[model samples]
Target: LLGRFFEARAKGRASQAITRLLELGAKQARLLRQGTQVMVDPLELVPGDTVIILPGEKIPADGVIDAGATSIDQSMLTGESHAVDRGPGDEVYAGTVNQQGRLEVKVTGVGPNTALARIARLVEEAQATKAPVQGLADRISAVFVPVVIVISLGVLATWWIATGDFADSLSNAVAVLIIACPCALGLATPTAIMVGSGRGAELGVLFKGADVFERAKEIDTVVFDKTGTLTRGAMTLTGLDSEADERLFLARVASLEAGSEHPVGKAVALGAEERDIELAPVAGFQAWRGLGATGIVDGVEVAAGRARFMADRGLHIPDRYLEALETFERRGHTAFLAGWGGEVRGTLAVADTMRESAPAAVAELRRIGIETAMITGDSRQTAEVIAAQAGIATVLAEVLPEGKATELARLDAAGRSVAFVGDGINDAPALAAADLGMAVGSGTDVAKEAGDVVLMSGDPMSAVVALRLARATFRTIKENLFWAFAYNTAAIPLAALGFLDPMIAAGAMAISSLSVVTNSLRLRRFH
Candidate 1:
């Protein structure tokens, strides 16, 4: 009975963490009905309902803001430390607090469809699953139970023949059986896993399964995807030079790029918009994958992309333009050349800022004796610069999107256990190929699904936290198992030798299980 109590207590503590997260859903929602506010249960909300959120109220459901603006505190959900500004057309998740301004949010998701609910479900499922170490304990316990019974029968017979006292012999046999109950062995691995994973969730890390804890501890090399993983993934136009009228050159390039869905193209278009440069309509816009784009901009033929694209188009590149391209590349900025009417007209440089946490994350990984590498589709000079900035020594530059998985395979072949961190649809393959895949929370659904661990904080430093937590959790499991095995080994013989009374042996068995539970609960204090 005492053993069962300890198990129940451990389970209760683990569930408490998850319960607190699920409670984020507001009980009542203030909805805008016919321009008047009506209070209703959050479950009654549906898509397209306009919910009014005032200062300090929890957002009732996931939705887009229809009117008004406010600073939303998402620290509880995403673990971001600062509140973010949200205005019309921006997304506000359910359970986040609205500060200062009133927001009219059009509901897009409700009930179980909310991000908070999904996170709770994921954590619950991970806890319910068993780790490989738990399976080993179960197998050992299965073999141990019958062997202990046989030994108990042997002790009963030996004592009866020697002393010829049935009552004394029975007590000794019963004591052996009581002390070798296997309760501690059963609770050892699972309790620790439950607490560790629960603590991980609070730190903005989510393990997809109990088994991921085992796999993560074995990772020796961590490969990070460059764009969204290390850098902010937002591009800015840093420099623009032109031989023709600067505004006209930018207008032409930005107009052709406006049709592109690429990040670089979007950056160019946004630069034009920020400068209030009116874009001319383009006819026959064609995008050459990984090279450049071409179109007829305001009746003039315009080609904008890499210098290689210019060379391919039979366009003349001036010496000054070549010098500018080299300077931009040397400075770790992506440079693009623009030309029209068979002559290179201008050059543009775009750069992405590195995340503030990236360097610290690399340093932490190194401190823990793990190797770090970076993989990117950028040019060699660009990748090297970014890698150096993050203090990463190994760089796999110019790797195509399809080649990421192959690069990870090479690391695996070299006997290195690799964990890949990424946040894009293109990274899904690599995320699956690594020994352990960690997906940033802000990544695409496909990438998250393929990853074994999801970093809900979307901070590179969280990856380091995940790894350290895994090692700590696994170490606790080992400790619990050792204590359970050692306690059984030492106590069984003492009970069989008539050195312990049956009541004393039962008390010892309960203490052994309680010790394991207490040890596992220590993980709750883990940071």
Candidate 2:
């Protein structure tokens, strides 16, 4: 019963982060009725019901926007600290906040169907799926009892013959069996694993299986996904270039982007708004994937996209403008060419800033002798700049989203055990494919499903903390096993001799268990 209590306590502590997540969920929501909005419980909502999402309010359900535009702070779900802009037709998730502007959302998911709910379910499943550590004690236990029986028989026959006393011979053999009960050996590995798992939970690092404690030490390389892993993943307009009237050029581009939903488009629109430029109304807005948007703004056909996208439209890009584009890209900014009337006007640049803790985190991994590399869908120049900022020297750039797992496999084929860290829908495959997949940040359900470890915080420094903790915990496990086995091996022979008694052997057995438990508790003090 005491052992069961200890095991239950540790398992409960290991799920603290998941409990904290559940607390953040809103219990009610404001719903849009036939002609007015009413406050109601979240359970009352159903698919197709329209919900009114005001500024500074949590979205009650996952659905597409019916009207209005606002920035939704999805940091808790996506681990993206930035507020993402959502307009009509854009999807809004339950548990995310509408930072600005009034929005009417058509509910597509509610109650158990929400992304937040799914994430909670994933956390529960992760805890349930965890298997106990298979240690040296279990293997020994299988044969130790049988071998002890044989030894006890041999001791009884020898003692009976030597002394010709039946009572003394039987008493000596009983003492030997009692002293080698393997009580401490049974307690050793489990106590340490429980405490270590709980300690990991306290640090917002969840160990899904006992195998992680064993496998983490073998990791030789750590692969990080660029967008949400190293960088803030919130793209903001940083630099812009124009041959004439820079503000006017920006206003023209922003007008066309007003109808678009791409991150780059939203960043451009936001940049123009900051300059207080009134967006010129646009018509016939056409958005092409991999290219940019083309629309009629202020009676002129204006265009914005990659350099190749501009060229395809028969636009003449100036040599100076081309040079400026290279300059922005070389600096790790995604640049676009804006044009009108067959002439390139200027360039717009946006960049995802590096997280402040990225540098220290990368350095820590390197100091510990783990090679770090970044795999990203971003262009090579952009990947290089961000990698340098994060102090990562090895960069695998221009890899498509689907190709991330392939890169991890390539590294594995080279005889390197890798740990991949990422937070994004597209990163799901790579997260599962890695030897040790760490789902960084808020731990979205999809990413969590594939990850071996889930980081509750968005800070990259937590990765360093996790690796160090794994090594420390595994060390404790080994220490406990050693003391347990050594104590049993030496005591059994002394108990078999006529010099030792049963009472003293029983006391020693209890003391050995107490020592193992006390040593395992030391992990709770780990940072």
Best by lDDT: 1
The digit string of per-residue lDDT tens for model 2 on 221-281 reads 9999887678877778988888779888888889998888766888889888888989988
Residue 335 of model 2, lDDT score: 79
| TM-score of decoy 1 | 0.93
Predicted candidate 1 versus true structure: per-residue lDDT over 325-369, tens digit per residue:
878878888888998999999889889989999999999999999
Backbone clashes in candidate 2 total: 0
Runs off by more than 4 Å, candidate 1: 1-5, 280-303, 313-316, 340-343, 443-448
Per-candidate clashes come to 0, 0
lDDT scores for all predictions?
0.88, 0.78
TM-score, structure 2 vs. true: 0.73
